[model samples]
Target: MSDSTVEDFLKSYNPEVRQLVLKTRAVVLAVIPDAIEQVDSPSKIIAYGFGLKYADLICAIAPYKSYVNLIFSQAAQLPDPRGLLTGTGKRARHVKIKTATDIESPGVRSLLEAAVASMTH
Candidate 1:
């Protein structure tokens, strides 16, 4: 069996959704410069973490047919005064990205930063 890569994973998404995912990925990488990114082809997710463990996971760029979601593992714990997160999950929440502008939304960077700090600190 061949190992799936981020490129291979993203290739399945549509062009517009691919751009949004790439933009979201750039923001995540910019916020967490040293983060290690892992790809899950089956889940259609590109996860970023400080280390190779479930607990170390900070966020994931999950792509769908029409949009992408920036999934945060610590969303419930993060102080999101801007209310950018949306999810009913007890431990995780996600911000939907329908456009590149959504990825650059005011609260997105802050949330990403907090997610990184939550695990590193």
Candidate 2:
């Protein structure tokens, strides 16, 4: 999707939810500067990947009514010693970010680092 599409998606949410989504996007991009952004309106999420295909997807930012989710695509393979990621999916897991501070927390940063590192191996 286009950049404008993503911008519109972010704007579609309520002010509070919109702010959370913007913060989540900032955190993800800050952690993985080279990650390619994929805006999927059908799924209502913005995904970041190392390559053009789904297999290269590293994570995603999904906005809900109450919070935004930082979704790790290969969460099953990442190191999560803190047990912060929550999910029952075969390969994906998510960390809910309710506020801006959650994005800067050490636990969240570590997870983002691990997810990006996984792209090389």
TM-score of each: 0.93, 0.92
Alpha-carbon lDDT, every model? 0.87, 0.86
Candidate 2 ranges beyond 4 A from true positions: 1-3
lDDT of 2 at 82: 83
Tens-place lDDT digits, model 1, residues 34-116:
88888877777888998888899999989999999999997999999989899999989999999888899879999998888
Local distance difference test, candidate 2: 0.86
Candidate 1 lDDT score relative to the true structure: 0.87
Q: Return the lDDT, model 2, position 60.
A: 90
Consecutive 10-residue window with the lowest summed lDDT within model 1:
1-10
